[model samples]
Target: MRDLTKGGKDRTIFIGKSLMTFLKGHFERYQEIKKQLGHEFNPNDLIFFNSRGDYLKLRELHRAYKNAIKRAGLKNARFHDLRHSHASILLKKNVHPKVVSEQLGHAKSSITLEIYSHVAPSLQEDAAHAFDEE
Candidate 1:
């Protein structure tokens, strides 16, 4: 409902086909639940919501995230760490930093590079090896 932080524009995050397939199934289940409850389906309804079809409060979201982390046997990770992890994975896989920056809604690609500079040394080595291969 609000503009994106860096660009003050609507941001779009493209999902993979697998995720789209899973979301399609999830939406069908939601529709079935609404039908059984005799509730009119509102397309504008939040995709993830409480049993009452209300958006979750911040505390509720945090609690659910904590529970998920515990179930996954992960420690010392905040929800925001997922963002950092995603960017780190993409950068390590040789995705352009500028593209990752835009995906992350960073004000500048430099910000993305600065934050993920730990991945740069391996990238530099990879580039050097590529030239040797050629």
Candidate 2:
């Protein structure tokens, strides 16, 4: 869940099945390691855990973000850029601004337009043909 505004707006993002499966597998492997340490398994444990079965910290989250981008060879990208990437892809697909705004949990559709609604070259070509006479 995410708080979209100071008080007025609210939105929640439901994770997809693929992400849930990946997290579930990670949790099970983490529990196996904990069992080797003679610790009890807690099914309600967090998504990321430390060696002592403690919840992971924000620093660790940042490290993983940075590491994954580096490993992916996205040398010029930042972790925050992935959200922009998602929005850009959606916009290029001709998805409506209102729908994209909700997915992004933005309080204003104008913000989505301001950021991502500009026509990229490929999408511009698609738009040109969309209304072409048969």
Candidate 3:
């Protein structure tokens, strides 16, 4: 995947089947829009773009995210919170920190551990109980 973050380093991230289906639907919509434009569509256009095939500005995307959060009645949520939420869910499900770090495009697993260590206590407790059972 393209690295749109400050690091500017490209990394691969796996998406779930549901996300793949969503992306396929999104691309199909884009193709339909392109067909409607009648010879105005660039084949090399970005996946996420405006009607004119221009990439969305960061501010525009942020505003949309904010609006969505507000509509969902979520308080104090930012777009970046989605990343943290994903990491937290994966960690809680017993995914390895290294895998999470790679998905997050962090420079190291230690960075993922550092940022999400708060989720670890419960996991540790679960491990202790499982060990006792064994």
Best by TM-score: 1
Candidate 3 TM-score versus the reference:
0.85
Candidate 2 CA-lDDT value: 0.75
The CA root-mean-square deviation of candidate 1, after full C-alpha superposition on the true structure, stands at: 2.0
Q: Give the alpha carbon lDDT tens digit for every residue of 23-131 in model 3.
A: 9999899888888886557556788875567778898888888999989898978778999999999999999889999998888999999999999898899899989
Residues 49-103 of candidate 1 have per-residue lDDT tens digits of: 8766777888989999999999999896899999999999999899999899989
Off by more than 4 A, model 1: 1-3, 40-44
Off by over 4 Å in 3: 1-9
* Poorly placed runs, candidate 2 (over 4 Å): 1-10, 38-44, 118-122
Q: What does candidate 2's lDDT look like per residue over 101-130, in tens digits? A: 888877789988877746456677887898
Please rank every candidate by TM-score, starting with the best: 1, 3, 2
Q: How well does each candidate superpose onto the true structure, as a TM-score?
A: 0.87, 0.72, 0.85
Q: What is the lDDT of residue 95 in candidate 3?
A: 93
Please list the C-alpha lDDT of all candidates, in the order they appear: 0.87, 0.75, 0.86
Candidate 1 local Cα displacement, residue 103, angstroms: 0.2
